[model samples]
Target: MPHQSTAPPTRFHRSIFARTVLWAIIIAAAITACLWLLTDATIRNTNQIALERAVDLDLAGMVDIHASGGREELARRIADRIALQPRDGQLAHYLLADTAGRRLAGDLRQWPGLHAGVSESGPIALPGGSAFARATQLGPDLRLLVAHEDHDIDALRRQVALVYVTGGLLATLAVALIGMTAAHRLRTRIERINAAFRHPDEEALARLEKGSLDRDEIDELTRHSSEALARLGRLAGAQRETTDQLAHEMRTPLMHLDNRLVKALAAAPEAETAARIADARLEIRHIVRMLESLLDIAASQARRGDRHGLAPVDLSALALRLGELYADSAEESGHTLKLAIAPDVMVEGEEMQLTRLITNLLDNAFKFVPVGGTVELRLAPGPSLTVCDDGPGVPLADREKIFDKFARGSEPGTQDGAGLGLALCRAIAERHQLEITLLPSTRGACFKVAPQARR
Candidate 1:
């Protein structure tokens, strides 16, 4: 029946580290794309310029031949150039034509669609593959065409694309690795701060105190949190001191008052006077009990704050011993007491506080259950303990409030209690880092107590 602490669920995309890495990769890809486009344009422009130059040189050679030996000489020169060039998987091609567009002597069969100056043409089907051609005219009638294959330019584009893609992938991976490392360091710092809050011990505080001038925002947070805890510790110490001093000062006066009331009860002669004195004595005893409970509460709080006087104790043995001690009392009260204790359940805590914690729970169960009803004490694995009574279960509305000081749920005047028993039980449990919760029952009240560590 122990309650658990709840935390919000975290999504992968929502994490700050994940978001940072994702954005970094996106920016890198965008930059790579821009660079690829720029490089592709540059390569294409350089190839085009080179192709134009080569075509112009060839045209100039043909013009020289024509000026030296007329049109026939130019045709003979073009034929020789074509015969000298290799045809197997050749990227470059050439063609020459006469004034009537009749084939003279060259690689090409006929004139391609072109202008006088260097112009781009397409896929002029050839032996090896398709081509992108640059054509120029040697004269108004004579035409010359030079072409480079499409596959050459395509291969260059593929090579550039491969380089960019590979580089982009490597860059993204590097960014991710760096981001993961940074995130791990950040998470460790955050966990340290959280541990400081949870433990708030001297060691934890000392770790927080070691600060640096080059610290980040997380360090600033750690400093602020440490300061807050120190302030709270001081205030808690002051409060404990005040409570202890007040309890000490009040005890003497209360004892003296109780003694005076006892003397008055003894001296009173008349029955009515003696009865009134008895009532005052009863009230004094109630006040004394309240004072003792308050002191116990303060002591438990102090122990929890400092974590002092802790030792390993056999909880199962302690529970068994308490059950044996209380069995007779239960029978005397006309209630059936039952015990179901396990063996060798060890826990780390102060024996005295743990004893009081269990005793308070049994006392409450015994006090509220109807005469002739059953009260059961159970100790099981996980070192869990439960006390149940076959009496009116606590009302739903009063379940939480019952653990507060001076808060009672039963009909007024029906129970003889000052309403501090459950509150004291809770204080002791908290001191031992235990959890106590009210369990659902079919017939009566059930309370379960167990170590928080087990949960």
Candidate 2:
């Protein structure tokens, strides 16, 4: 035979940290892109404004000098003055031209073919090669032109470059810090998981669960794991109890069958046959009841969420109807059954589930009450239902246990049930977000189911 798989079963398992980090990196990239767009727009606008102002200032001085008719002398002086200024030649290299398109005192071999005012003129080949020119008309026939170097706006380029570099560096730094913090917390959580996985033993789990490490995605996983362990512990205890109960329940019938067989063997033949048949019928009924109880438990668990849809239910009317249905049975059993339903009581729930919940409580009351005992069903405007019986009430210690699957307050030898009625009742009530509790009673079991107001 092929080897069977030994891997543990799991529901959707994956790393939460990986998902969180991936999302963080994506968000950081988006922020960086947005910063680049805004910075680029601002820088370009500032550079254009500054370049226009520089041209205007230089043009004003040139126009004043040319209008005075100080042609050759003024051009020479202007060039000399430009050379002496701090950022004069540094801002732009000049190429001055006279009115008849003649080269003047600046660097150009000829006029740049424009009587200009802050306009683009480019690809003007000189001894060096092609270049870009920013020219402005200075006089009737004289033009003053400024051309940037062939290296292509290096200074302004550097400023934009620096902005991006700084922005990228900052983005990288932030991402690194976030990634480091995430990884550190992730490592701690993985360590805890490893420790818990290796020892699954309580002490290790307790240390991991109780110790407040750091708050991150890992903390969520650790908390979930802790909760899962607690649930598993409860499930294990319940399983043990169920196993013990099943064994005990099966043994009783088997023992009775054995005694019946022995008794039949020693009796007269005619009576012996009848005695054996009766014993057989009893054993069959016991087995059938056990099977029916098991089916009910399975059905209840399967139908847990089938009643989730909202429906308006009149609680008081339903209680009154159930009270009437059980009245005759209660009288025949020599127990007094009474109903006290408040007017206009309503709730939002599945009518069938609510009905079943009430029926189970009344069933338990009827089972426990002795002859001439009283069972009362009460409903009030408080939107609560209470059932009380005049029988031995449940002990304080067994209150919670009585609602557990296959649990009963009394010993199995005395009770005639599979011990699932109260558990089913609790499940049905809880599904509707109703609170059911064992209330204090004078001499009998009293229980209440209180539902919250619906919005």
Candidate 3:
């Protein structure tokens, strides 16, 4: 299995869209509330001042009437003013009384219950509403009260407040909807860039839209990243070409030399000469094997995700066959080769590469395991192939490094050829989009081949 990140996502990785939306709502609500408060204060203050001025006009008119014709004329003028009062929403109250508190003449029925003098400058509660009232002592025996009814002002404020809240709520909802839509588009574009970064291949980079001066930082990053990927792709292509050429060009000469040595060994007469010729041939064969393994590794690595010649491979049958082939060799070496492959297991791959992957793992286990050690091959439902041996298990430090080319295990066996077996195995597994892991075991090495985890 591929390595997985078990670490928790930090604050930055959490749903930033949600946080942004929440903050937006808070700010919108706050702004809306502040606007409402300012408007309400202005409306209340301006209306109060206007109503007070009208009260002053009414008070002056009554006071002048009293100054010219005494209290009786003042009461008569008050009645006339009330009779001619316009039917507008603004209402004015008038009250006149003797020093003994008897109603002389006015619209009000009785003196408003209030502190004697100062209460006139403040709001006084009326029967069905409230009013600003002012009282003036006309003479030793008479009093005058002028007041303005302002209940409509209170009602207007309430209606306006309700409207403001409604508008604020609607505006907030609209902003939320717009924010969500914009965030979704942003996340989509960001995820595409993130996916491109994850692959970092020229093909993936080309799919990204090019950035211009009009765009933001993300697009600029994409533009630079595409250029970087192109450079990397070119470098990788050159490296792959070099490796392919070296592996392919060296093969003919190596085979020719091996063939010449074989003939030389056959024609040699003395035992010593024959032995030396055979050793030379063996060395040639080892070199030839190393070159072929290197070629396989390079080819598989180059074609990692190319499923051009892939077909449905019956892994169960293949594992069974390889198990049978190696069973005799295991027995000859005084070891048991146990096969636990499930039936009808299958995978999509090139059979030849899969065969090499399995054989390399088996060869590796055999090389390390002592005589009489047991080797177990398990092929379960995951198309998982695990090769276990009762030999020296891989050292803790060398587990990850052993997959690299020319890297050998801690336990050096006598036949540790060019250490390309595990590397080739990893390449083939990667070509099939699989992962090969060195599982921890109590006794010997246990290598498991399975599907790579989706990050």
Candidate 4:
């Protein structure tokens, strides 16, 4: 009754939507990181090269000016640089000093101690930022130093990194949205195929058989599966038809033979001869019962999972009515029929078939248990019915085997039965989408009918 969930149901965490989001995030992060690394490396190298060139040219020009016109001319050029770009002075260092270490007309607090004589170049700290610098001992008297600040380059790198971050976020969002849409459509298509099998009908089957002209693996699978189902349906229909025809053909003659036996019993000259004829008639009756039971099993099997003719049946009331009807029989057999029935336990099924299912279970219990034994029938909220008998319980070996058609229990008293009762009970339960199981019992055989979900 409780069928398995969808094939795609359990692994939802690994679905297309989830995988797409994960991969999108990974790709976006990788790209953004690579760009940031490249920007930092390239800008660092360019900053170093730039600082070297600017300082080299400034020192060269100062050397020529100081050699030709001494400290007067060199100091004038440094002063012109400071006056033209005051902000530039924050990044571009300038200094000119005499042998006494007294500053000339340039923007420097004091002449810095340059370690590498002649031409010095390396990283140096300045107020508010860091920089790369080059210093020179010009003409052994007037010193000139030049440096370039890196705060502007650091700000530029951060701006580029921000742009990359925004782009990665947008990429992740866009891929996530696209993945959801694709997963929805793909999941819907898969569910459509599952629905056809769950509640198969002419239209759904036909649709599957026709399939899509689209070039996809799922569509191809549907087409192949539909063909298989069609084949199986044809085979099952033929088998049922042939079996029904044989059952029908054999029924009339079996009835006529029984009627003839009855007539012969009436006309027999001696009590012995009449007794023999009566026994024959009894055997004939058993055969007829077996035949009818087989037909019922076959009918129920054919009707399995078909919801067309079903309606809500009050199973509680039905059990109550059957219990009352069997009370007389139970008393005659010196057995107590105890019913612990709940109210309004409804089920979806044919009343006649459900009645037969319960009837067969009751008959099996009554047959197995000896006189003076107790038989209990329970009805509960799950529309669950259980019939248990205080008889020699079914052997463990035959428990599962006994449900098969024509499977007889190996216990001593089981021979008289045609072994169709439990088989028919199983078929009827399945037809109503319920499961009947041989529950574990301490003292007797107990059979329970309920939906699979409860189990």
Candidate 5:
């Protein structure tokens, strides 16, 4: 089996880009909220100050008329003038009160509960309706109250509301524009970084030959990617050269060794020579198997494609064949092997590879099972194949690791061949996008292979 390379697991971590964007949004929200509050407070303050000024000017005019001994005459004239302004659906309530809060000549029924020296203010609601009011001391014993209904104040309120809404919308739009620009720039930079991580292969070679760098983040990324790829390219090139050299140098020698062993065994004159020939043959098979597994891994990796000659292969027949093949050996070892194939079970995949996968699984089951134990081969329409054996079940800790190349639970130097069987099976199953699982069973290992189409 070929050596497998796997990476260690790491804790989940947030990216720098995510953190930057999150902080940007938080700051934008805070600034917008502060601006809204300030704008709202200023509008209210300005309206109250203007209203106070208007009320004071009106009060001064009334005082001038009273001083000229035109109190009754001016009151009639001012009342007529005030009545001339439209009062329909308008809150206009006037109150003339003494220092002791006694009503005089106005439509208001009573004085409002306001603290002295409190003047500048906007609208407030009373039992009668809504009004904006201002009040002042007219003399030592008289007070003047002037107020207008909230119709004009309502219009002003609407205007202020509209301003705040428009301001908020504009702020949001500006934030969106700024965020998009920053994100675009950041994305461009990161793309270049990512291009650096990819392997240098044929496509990368073509890109290098293009000899063009736009000189942005993407370019930096491409340059870094090229450097990493170059390193991997050199390593892969060296490895390929070594493999080719080994195959060229060893194939003939191995064949010669096998030929010599066979010939010497045929004319052996002693038990010692026969035993030596047997050992040589066994060693030669082991070397050949190792080389073959390597060649398979390399060829699969290089092709970058799956075999395309797919057809519906009857899984039931395959299971029956395996059951019959292993039944004799299983019986010889005082164990029982059985086939429980459902009729017309079919799957779509490479027939040869699937057969080998099943064969390897059965071989493992047989090797692991104790005498008088039972091994069952099940083939069904829905899922395809399940190989179970009443042997020592694989421990939970070893289940995942056993699928790795050259990994086995058996003691070293005892198993007959390299532990490539399960790894090869897994590779073939994955190429077809099928799921293979080791199901918990009663006292043994149970493996199930389910094809995508069947599932």
Candidate 6:
């Protein structure tokens, strides 16, 4: 099938770090508001208590002055106290009133309308700004009012507000920093774990070293992944050994059989007998080729994610050279070969393996194209390679299946192939971290081989 690329859907809350930071900010704001309200209420209560205590002290002083020296002495004492306080920044006001609610003497101009006992009065217009008065009854016919300027309490409130605001901002910043740091660490660890899974070899496992005993979720994951990779390595090793032993055991007998068939054909005198011997030898040779192809597939699969043998290869040059080498064969088969390759298109891969991969693609294209049809090999930027032929395109139903070993296209009987060509191509592409897929074309087949990044 023509490969189709689908992008993963995006979600807003995908990042754990972002979610954590958002929640942290919300919680911090709530806590900050609650603390501010509590602190504000406590400070207001304390201020009120201090103001009331001062009023009570003033009332007591006025009563003592009145009892000791009568109204004349009481008025004189009040005037003296008022005079002692600074006029420009007076915080306290005192009012002495008689039975008829007339101000006797004090800084206050009139008797405040209040019930008997201590009562608070707000923002009463004063010379500077505003004042709050605390009134108390000193006698059956006498009343005393004490007022303090509101600026002092307002200043105190402002200071407390500043502290609350500063604290709230610092707390929010600290929370954000902590959340970001934690998120970064988590993402890094997750990426490392993903890499280990992609390359499940001893080196990848060794890199996922055992963490501390008091392990977190990430550490535990690493531990488990290491164990899994180790197990996978053992299994792969066993499979490779088995493949090697089977190849050896099978190829030895096949070699002996081929030798016996050759000797039989040489000894046969009759033309019919010699023809039968030749047919058997051809079948044996086909089996031997199948075995070799199978071994190549196994080796390619085993080398996936292993870069030890990789080196820089000029893919453009390789494609052009192969096209030239196969030109004579194409002409012999009554097909035209064309090359449109750009120079200096380098890639990191095994040169021998990459050559085989390209060769297989070109061979398959040539095999399917009819006489007088054109097979073109093109190399372009992104280090992409393509082999296109004006042949019957891959059927939609068989496109995906054609990459499987022993899978044939719709016109299978028209072509002579073991059908492992595309499968081997896929194996080689995977080993080099490349992508190979059939591209949709209107009248022909176009197979693309390119780096994964390009895909």
Among these predictions, the greatest lDDT belongs to 3
- TM for candidate 6 is 0.74
Cand. 1 Cα-lDDT = 0.77
lDDT of the candidates, in the order given: 0.77, 0.69, 0.80, 0.79, 0.67, 0.80
Q: Which stretches in model 6 have alpha-carbon errors above 4 Å?
A: 1-41, 56-78, 94-120, 123-129, 135-145, 150-224, 302-309, 331-334, 342-344, 412-415, 451-455
Task: Rank candidates by TM-score, best first.
Answer: 4, 6, 1, 3, 5, 2
For model 5, name the residue pairs that clash.
Answer: 91-149, 192-221, 196-225, 334-372
TM-score of each: 0.71, 0.45, 0.69, 0.77, 0.66, 0.74
Could you tell me the TM-score of candidate 4?
Answer: 0.77
Residue 59 displacement in candidate 3 (angstroms) = 3.8
Model 4: runs farther than 4 Å from truth?
2-11, 14-89, 94-122, 134-145, 153-162, 209-211, 266-269, 298-321, 342-352, 381-384, 430-434, 453-455
What residue pairs are clashing in model 2? Answer: 99-141, 116-137
> 2 or 5, which is superior by TM-score?
5
Residues 251-360 of candidate 4: C-alpha lDDT, one tens digit per residue: 88888998988787767658888888888888888888899898889889987876646777888899999999888899988999999999878787799998998899
Query: Taking the tens digit of each residue's C-alpha lDDT, what string does model 6 give over 317-357?
Result: 88888989999898888999999999878777888988999
True-structure RMSD, every candidate: 5.6, 16.1, 6.0, 4.5, 7.4, 5.9
Backbone clash total, candidate 5: 4
Ten contiguous residues minimizing lDDT sum, candidate 3: 1-10
Across 83-167, the per-residue lDDT of candidate 5 in tens digits comes to 8766666445566667788876566767776542455445556666766777766567776677765346657666866776677
Error of 5 at 32 (Å): 6.2
lDDT of candidate 3 at residue 160, scale 0 to 100: 92
Using lDDT as the yardstick, the better of models 1 and 2 is 1
> Candidate 5: worst 10 consecutive residues by lDDT?
1-10
Q: Candidate 6 at residue 291, lDDT? A: 92
Once superposed on the true structure, which residue ranges of model 1 sit more than 4 Å away at CA?
1-89, 95-120, 123-128, 134-145, 150-192, 212-219, 261-281, 295-328, 331-334, 337-354, 378-385, 396-400, 410-415, 426-437, 449-455
Ranked by lDDT, the better of candidates 2 and 6 is 6
Better model by lDDT, 2 or 3?
Answer: 3
In candidate 1, list every pair of residues with a backbone clash: none
User: What tens digits encode model 3's per-residue C-alpha lDDT throughout 1-455?
Assistant: 22232222334337687578777988999999999999999998999898888877777778898899988898888888778877555377788988777888887888877444443566777775788887877877878998888757778999999999999999999888888787777766666666665555555666764432328886787677677767766876798889878877887787788888778777866898888878887887898888888878888997786554677888989999999999999999998999998998878888898899999899888888888899999999776899999987888778779889998766555336788999999999998889899887778889999998879
Q: Give me the displacement of residue 101 in model 3, in angstroms.
A: 7.0
Span of ten consecutive residues with least summed lDDT in model 2: 1-10
